[model samples]
Target: IRILPHVHDTGAFFVALLEKVSPLPGEKIYKEKDAEEREAGESGSETQRVRQPPKKKQRTGFKEEPYFYFEKDEPIWPGISQFYDMNPEVDPTHFLSRTNDGKKRNLYFTNKLVKDVVTLNQDHIKIINTGVKVLVRSDNKGADCDFRLAQEGSQVLLPLFKKRKISITRDDMVTMLLNDDMCEPPEIEKMDTKTQEQCENLESGSLAFTHKREDGVEITLVGWKGAKSVRGYVAKHDRIHYLRLLNADTSKYEKNKYQEQRDLLQKNGSIDDNNENSNEILAENGTTKNDDLENGNITEVKENEIKNNENVDNEDNGNGNGDRNGNDHEMEINKQTG
Candidate 1:
C-alpha cells in the first residue's frame, strides 16, 4: 500500500495511508475542490496559507485523514568538503594531495571537483560515519576557506550558485568533460594569485622533447624557472615523457667559469707538446679534451697506412709480371738459337 505524505516547507507534516478500512456512514470523501473553496471563503490574503498545496486522493476503500506528523530539522551551513562526499556520481579524475607543514596528511579531490560542489550546493552532503572529518579550515588570512566532507546520512540542500533553485546533490564534473564542455570555474583573482605566480616563475627556454607511441604521443616539457626539477606527464594513451631542467643561474655560472679558463689557456700561448701531454694526463684522470683533432687522429692514421700498403702490393705485383715476361722472351731466344 502506498503512503502519501503531505509535506510543508515549514515544520508541519501529514500522512495519508491506503488501507482496507471502511468510512463511517455520515462521513464524505474528501475533495481538493472543497478544500480550495473553503480556503478562498475563509481567507482573502495569500499570507494566511503557509502550508503546501493539498494533494488529490484516490478512492480505494480506505479511510484517509491526517495520520502522522513530525517536525523538520533546519539545514546546516555546508562546508566545502561536505559538497564532494554527498554526491556519489561526482567524477574524481583530478584528485589533489594537500599537505600541511610537510608532516600533516590530508587528501581531497582537486579544486575542479570542489568547485562543482560549491556550484550545485547539494543539501544531502554530510559527514562520513567512519572516516575522519576531512574538513579543515585554513589558518592563513588569505585562505579563509572551510573544508568538510559529507557524512553518510546527510540530505542535500539547495543549490548554492542558483537563486531559489534547489539541488539535492552535487553534479558530476566528469560528465562535463565527457560532454566536451569546459568544467573550469570562473577564476577568482585573489584566490588564484599564488598559483599563477608559481606557474610564471617556471624558467623559460629549456629543452622540450616529443616522443611518439602507437596509441598516443607524449611531449616532455622542461623549463627552468629557478631550481632544477623533473616532472613527467602522460599526454595521450599510456605513454609518458620524463622532463628535467637544469638550474639556469647555476648552469650559467659554470659556463662562465669554463670560458674564463679557456681564455686563460689561450693567453698563456698556443697549446704545445708539454701542454698536450698535460691535457692527455688530465683526460686519463677523467677530464675530457675539447679538441676534435686529438680524438680523430688515430682513425686517420690507420686509414693512411692501409692505403700505402695497398699501393706497395700493386708495385710488387707489377715487378713480378715484368720478370716473368723477361724469362719467357729469354726462353724463346734460346729456342730460336737451337
Candidate 2:
C-alpha cells in the first residue's frame, strides 16, 4: 500500500488493489436437507441420519417499528396540504411516521426510490433511519394547521408550496437574519411595506421566505409567523449558510476565539506602547523628581522661588558695600585727628 498525499485539506489516505494469483481446488457447495428428510429426522423414523442446516436467527434489532406511510385518507395530510397550497404533483403518500397509532408527532418524507427500498426490504434488513423530517406536531391553537414545516425538508417542499410563501427584499432578509433573538423575533413593522402586507394576512405558523437577487440568485429560508413577530426556523449553521447566500453578515454567529484572542492581545500591546511612551515623556519632563505628580502649579512655584532667591542675594550684596564704605570713612577721620 502507498500513502496518498492530502488534497484540499482532506485527510491523507492509502490505496491498494488486491488480485488472486492462484486458484484453489473447487469444493462442492452444500445444500439444505429437504422438508421430508428434516421431518423424518425429527420424528426418528429415518434409518440414515440427515444433518439439518442451521436455522437463521432473526436480528435482535429488527423489533424497531417500521415506517408507516401516510395514506390519502390520513387526517394530518389534508390540513398540511391545504395550508401550504401544495401542488397536485406532490404526493402525500411519500410522508411517513414511526408510529402507526393516530398520534404522530413528526412526519418524515422519502423519495419514491427510498420508500420502495424501505418497504420491500424491511423484513430482510434492519433500517436504522430514512427520509427527511418535513413536519412537526405543533398544536398552536391560533394556527389553522397543526403541523409546522421543518427546515430540513423546506427546500424539498418549497417549489411545491404556494400560499404560505412570501417574496422578500434584501433588506427584509437581512433584518430577519440579524435578529437572532428567539424570545423577541423581528417584528412585522420593522420589515418593508411589501413584506408587512404579505405577513399581515399570514397565520401564525411556519412559512417560506424567498428573495431573488438582481444577479438571478434566489435564496429560500424557512420562517415562522406569529401574532407579534416573525422568525426564521434555521439551525445555527444553516442560518450562517443562508446569510452567506444573501450576502448578509454572519460574523455574529461565526466567532473565532483564537482571532478574538489575537485582537485582544494586539489591543493590549497598543495600550502598553502608549503607556511606555507616556512614561518616557514623564521622565524627560522630570516628573519623577517629585512624588506629587498631580500638582498643577509645581513648575510655576519652582520658578517663582528661584526668582525670589536671586532678588534677596542682590539686596545683601548692596547692603554689604554700603556698610564697608561707612566704616572706611570713620577710620580715615580718626587717623587725621591723631
Candidate 3:
C-alpha cells in the first residue's frame, strides 16, 4: 500500500503485510484454469498438473549454543561475579557458545537474550541481526588483563558489580570518561579496599568500574587499569551524559569536572546567554540523549542552575537520525556558556 503526502495532503507512508503459505504435506500443485475463455473445457490436458517441490525440514526450536563448560572459567568468573550476588536460577555454563576459532574463547552471559530473540529467525524469516554479544573470551590476553570485556557486555555484568565492593567516586568517573584509550584509572587508590586489593594483584588490564550514583543508580564503566592509571571506554553518547551529569553538580565531584564540561561546549562554539531561558530537557525516561554535531541537527539544553545534588535532567541522546560521527562519542559536545 502507498500514500503520497504532497498530492493528497496526507502524510506520505508505505506499508505491506505478507501471508505465509507453506504447501501441505503430500498436497499437489494445480494451476487455475481460465474460466471465462474456456467454458466446456476439453478432457485431457485442460487441467495442467504442476509438480510441487518437497518441503525442506524447518528448524523447530531454537538452535542451542554449544555445551562448553563455563565452570572452566571459574577462576575468571570470581573476579567479576564476586561484586554482585549470583543468580541461583542461571547456570553459567548455559551461556557458552560454539567457537571453532583456534583462539581461546570466553563465555558471555546474554541473560537469555539470544533465546528471547530466536523466534525472529525461525520460520524462514530473515534476521539481519538479533542477539547482543554478551561474552568475551576470558582466557585470551588483553594489554592489561586476561579478559577484555565488550562495552555492552560490561553493562550486562554491571548489575553484578553495581552493589559490589568496587564503587568509584564521581571524580573518578570523569577521569575514566576523559582518559585516552588504554590509560589507567587515576583513583585506583580510592578504590574500595577489597576491590583495590584485587586490582593490585591483577596485572595491567582488566579495568571495570561500577559507579554507584547517589540514590543507588548504577552505571558500569569498563576499561583497563594498570599500575598507574585505569583506562576506560565510554561510548560517544554516554560521554555526553556523563559530562552533563558531572557538570550539573559542579561541587559534587570536583569543580574541575564541571569546568571541563563548560569548556567543551565553548570549544565547539556553542554559547549563548539568551539560550538559557529557552533550555531543552535532555533526559528522557531516565537516561540522557546525546546528539551528533556533524549533521548540524544538535539539540542543546542549557543547565541554567548548577544544582549541587539534583541530577542533570538531559534527554536521552540517539544516533538514529541522519546525525553522524566517528568521533567515538554519541552526542556532540555543545559549548554552552552557562
Candidate 4:
C-alpha cells in the first residue's frame, strides 16, 4: 500500500494491491441458502400466503423512431435528383428520413458504415438519431425543387451536386456574408462579373457557393437565391467562422467586454494622471513662494539688528569723548592752583 501526498491542489489518497486467497467460512453456506430461497420463490411454494401482485412491465428509455431509407425509384428522389443534377453513382439509399409515412420533412445522409449499423441493429437497439441533415422540405410553390439543400450537409454533398452550384470569389463571398438583412439580400448584379454570369440562369432556391484560394484551400457555403438577390444561409456564429477563414473583418460580430473595460480604464487613467500633474505643479509653485517669503523675512530682521548695533557704538564713542574733555580741564586747574 502506498499513500499519496496532497500537493498541488490534489486530494490525499492511497493505493493498495489486494489479493483474495480464500473465501469466508460461511460464504458457501450463504450462497446455498440464497439459491434455495430463489428456487423456492420461483417454484411458488408460498402461494398460501397473501402477496402483492407484480407490477406490469413498463417501457422505458427514449422512443424508437426507425429510419426509412429512400429507394432509387422513390417518387421524391426524381425531383431532387433532377434539380441538383445528382451524380448517377451516388445511391439514393444512402439518404433516409425519420418518418416511414409519405410526409417526410427532412432528409438525412449517412455513409456506408453508419447505414449498415443502423440497418442491422435497428430492431435490437434504440437509435435516437443518425446521419447529417442534407435536405429539408421547403414547400415554396415558386421554387422548382421541393426540398432545399441544408448547410449542415453541404460539405459532404458538395461534390455530388453539379447544378445549382457556382464558384464565387473572396470579395463576393464577403459581400454575401456581410448582408445581414434576409429581406434585402445582396443583388446578383452587384457581385463580380463571373459570379453574376454564373447566377444569371439559376432559379430561386438553395445554391452551393464555392471559393478557392491560390493555396488550394477551398470553402463551400450554402446560399439561397431570391428573385433578384442572393445571400448566404450560414448562421451568425458560422458566418464569423467563415469570415475568419477568409481573412475578412468580423469585428462587428465579436464583442470583448474585457477589452472595453481596459480601454475605459486607460482613458480614465489619463484624466487622473493629468489631474495629479496639475496638483504637483501647484504644490511646487506654492513651495517656491513660501521659501522666498521666509528668506525675505530673515534678511529684514538681520538688517534691523545691524542698524541698532551701529547706533549703540556711536553713542558710546560720544560719551568717551566728553569724559576726555572733562579730564583735561581738571588737570589744567590743578596745575594753576599749585
Best by lDDT: 4
Local lDDT at 128 for model 2: 77
User: Candidate 1: misplaced stretches above 4 Å?
Assistant: 1-77, 81-88, 91-105, 108-138, 144-338
Better of 1 and 2 by lDDT: 2
lDDT for model 4:
0.73
User: What are the lDDT figures for the candidates, one per model?
Assistant: 0.29, 0.71, 0.48, 0.73
Identify the runs in model 4 with alpha carbons over 4 angstroms from their true place: 1-64, 256-338
Kindly give the number of clashing pairs for every candidate. Answer: 18, 0, 29, 0
> In model 2, what lDDT does residue 268 have?
42
Regions of model 2 farther than 4 Å from truth: 1-56, 60-63, 256-338
Winner by lDDT between candidate 4 and candidate 2: 4
lDDT of 2 by residue, 234-293 (tens): 666776777888778889766686765455444443444465654543332222222122
* Candidate with the greatest TM-score versus the true structure: 4
lDDT of 4 at 209: 92
lDDT of 2 at 244: 87
Instruction: Residues 98-203, candidate 1: write the lDDT tens digits.
Output: 3322422232333454545533532334312212222222222211122221211111221111111111101111111111101121121322344334434433
Which candidate, 2 or 4, would have the higher TM-score against the true structure?
Answer: 4
